[model samples]
Target chain A: MRSDRQNRTPMGLKIAAAAGLAFLHLPLLLIFVYAFTTEDKSYQFPPPGLTLKWFAVTWNRPDVWDALTLSVKVASISTVVALVLGTLCAAAISQTRFFGREAISLLVILPIALPGIITGISLRSAFNLAEIPFSFWTIVLGHATFCVVVVYNNAVARFRRMSGSLIEASMDLGADGFQTFRHVILPNIGTALLAGGMLAFALSFDEVIVTTFTAGQQATLPIWMLEELVRPRQRPVTNVVAMVVVLVTFLPILAAYYLTRDGDQISGQGK
Target chain B: MPHAVTFQQVSRHFGAVRAVDAVDLEIAPGEFFAMLGPSGSGKTTCLRLIAGFEQPTSGHIEIFGETAEGVPPYRRHVNTVFQDYALFPHLNVADNVAYGLMIKGVGRAERAREAEAALEMVKLPGYGGRKPGQLSGGQRQRVALARALVNKPKVLLLDEPLGALDLKLREQMQEELKALQRALGITFVFVTHDQGEALSMADRVAVFNEGRIMQTGTPHEIYRRPQTRFVADFVGSSNVLSPDLTARLGGPRQWASLRPEDIRLDTDGHHRGRVIAASFLGSATRITLEIDGETLSVLLPSGSAVPEPGEEVAFSWSPGDLHVMGDEA
Candidate 1:
């Protein structure tokens, strides 16, 4: 009876699952389809025609290049910051017992749990009070607030799953604190940090809500794409840029998924 | 000569629970010693104290006559084979074995040679390149053993290292470990809850219960003369005769104990019983008898004519077999 329950899914549940997946991905599919549509200014039930012209148009645009470069730079910097801070936070949270440790962990994850607009507005206000003018660094900082949460989530889960005996054994086998960290702890946590960093890079790459608040004049690719949507530029070109952003963001997330999927089978410390 | 390891009035308390309390122990150099106990019995905690992984709450621990207080595990001249092996999964067999040599700043080439020698010592000569995940339970145990031994420390600590292996493999490893300890001529302090393992391998055994040492003696002495009820029951099975029986048959002692093997059935001897139950073991038949309304177990050799349940029989034991116990019994 238990096995039968697992094997047979109700039709309603199957339909709901499919509907949920379509709700998420169908819009992204439409963006991909419209990227090659010949219609430059409007949408149609089916593309009246198709062309390779948008690819050329997007390639030649210097604004696109600048925005893409800026987004890449911000994501890269934010991911680096997230990796360092996130792993340290995870190590501290999991490996130690102190008062308010749970509270600190909750605080670490609060930024991501809050709506992006709230984080963006708060960062903007903090930057304003400090008299700090918005720049590339401000955009990077805005994205890093959430990026750290992503990295920390991945890292702390892995940290909790890891066996503490590995560290103790290293010390017992004659490794000092530094040696144990270097040889034992680091290797154990390395792949989790990598996956977390890649995920952070993806999250920062396509982020628009926070960028709009922190980025004053400089436009990241997503911000520039938002501008193109408002103005009467080549509509297909906007879709083409959207395609680039999707691929850029999607690949890392896919890689991160695979990294974490295989991560469950850690280097086996037990028989 | 100074003892290899000594603990004087050691106590370790966590919050309100005494994980290890007022324990005093001494191990001679090159001794194959076993700390035997059930889980949460403080055997592992005592081993940890000697390795400097844990500190005494209010007493002294010495290793090779040097105070172990406040000393780090890495600084202490000791190494451990953790119960789960704890071989670094990222490293292959050789690299795991060479971890200590690398930490000591030995040159890479020299470390490699020693690691190879260590692997050979553990009888896994060609397995240097295989990851720990590729090895079986017994092989991983050997790797962990070699990893600790490579440092040539004065003392080696094993925390239930064979707990994961199957019965046959556990027995094999027990023999191999005993032989290895003899070959190395280094003090080995091993923790295990298996009474048979302690009896078959250790030169001396310390029985722990409830964060306290119950007794320490050679396996023969411990089994033949358990001082406390815990030792009698934990180290090996024993039957504690009732107070009435002790007063009648225990001569002058306040309490009396007898091993099951010591109790014999003669069918013609003085004491009489009706066999209440019988189990056919491979080498011996376990016979449970009701004698004078109290239960007594006897082991009769297999292939002999065993009395059926409800059959009346006679049993007897020599005066020397009635081992006495303290009030703690």
Candidate 2:
């Protein structure tokens, strides 16, 4: 009976899926092709020879290297901060029945759902009112605000899937409160935490709008790419850096998907 | 010794619903106690209160005579085997068993040694390297037992611990758990909705209804001398007759309950009834008979004379076998 449906998918669906796959991968293929182009000035197709000159140029540029290092540092710090705060919030909201809990949860997820420009503008205004200087730390703070929502969603979903009886069992087994969290609760949510951290790192690494607002003079890789795009003195080098960004960010996302795929079904079942 | 556990009129409320209401119980050291009830009868809630996962809305709980107020579950000298087993999927069997010991700061070597010993006690000595996902249902249950017992708790709480197993495995584990309790000499508080599980394993059983304890006594006392209609009906299969029908046999305002095995079905007896249905079980034959508009079920040994449906049969039971309850509801 099941096999009958398996053999009967319409031709339209197959064509649509092929189109969707091409749509997603074509831009990535273009970026890779342009990164190796010999013509260093334009984005024209079919005229440029292939060369590895942009790769060597990208490796030597001090500004690009500094921007890459800054992006990594900001992503690491923001991810850590988001993980601790998001985990605590998820644990608090998951285990207890308190007043306005649903409202608080909605508020927690609001930052990630809102437009990034709006978050950037709001953070900029807030910093102006507080009269605080903008630096690398401000960029980390800006990224963390939205990054926390991703971590919170992942962690809370994992917590909800977890059997409450496990925590109760740990406590009953002569484990202190800390011990129960360390031994039982933490182990159960470890996969979710890793997935959330990876996702948050990827998000922070590529965040451009908020980084532009918070970064006064220092540029992250994303901000540097934006600057290079507007003033195209080194177009091929920019393509090379863009390809590198895509690779670095894509690997973590794939890892996060694999880590969280099994438990993702839990939320669907919960509904 | 003082009672291993005590609940002093414990009551817990979630909003307007009382999950547990004014429950008072005392469990003795080294005794196998069972709380038997239907779903939502507060048996599991009461177990959670004792486990410190929940705090009472009123009253108090004590472990070994010390007030359990503000005492975290890890600090209390009690362990629980959860209904779902709750074995850590990330940890192998040995690490799971050693979890409680590690929490108490036991050295790695000693904790591993004790975990192995606990696994041996549960008869799963070589299963230490397997994840819970790799183990069968029965093996998982045994690992859960080993993990809890490795801590050497003063009292062990099992919340429907065998609920996930098949019937045959459930019966096997029940006997093994009872024997383990006796061998360890630790107090055990087992919760289950299955009356048979409670009756066969517990030294004493507390039958719960609604949110209160209907009765608590030795299994024989509960079965042979039920104090309420609920107790008799919940504990075992009973033919409960109203006061009007039992009035001719005894007094008014008295309901009678008779076990199926106690009622004899023969060709020559005082009371006569027509068989409505007959089911042939492997070891016994069950005949449902209607007497004076009331239905009575009789269980006779296999290979006994099988009465056809609609055939008249004589049914009677010894007067001493009848359990009578006063109008308390």
- Best model per DockQ: 1
DockQ for every prediction shown: 0.71, 0.68
Angstrom error of the Cα, residue B227, model 1: value is 0.7
lDDT of each model, Cα atoms only? 0.88, 0.86
DockQ of 1: 0.71
Q: Which candidate is the best by TM-score?
A: 2
lDDT of 1 at B158: 94
Q: For model 1, what is the error of residue B102's alpha carbon versus the real structure, in angstroms, after optimal superposition?
A: 2.0
Task: State TM-scores per candidate.
Answer: 0.88, 0.89
Clash list (residue pairs), candidate 1: none
Worst 10 residues of 1 chain A by lDDT: A262-271
In the predicted model 2, the residue pairs found to clash are A175-B74
Global lDDT of model 1 = 0.88
How well is each residue in B17-60 modelled by candidate 1, as lDDT tens digits? 99999999999999999999999999999999988888888999
- Per residue, candidate 2 scores C-alpha lDDT tens digits across B1-329 of 67988888989888898888898899888999999999999998888788887888999888898999677777778888988899887789999899888877899999989999999999998888888889999999999999999888888999999999999999899999999999999999999999999989999999998889989999999898888888888888777768876775454657877788898876577778899999988899998988778888889888788889999988778878877777663
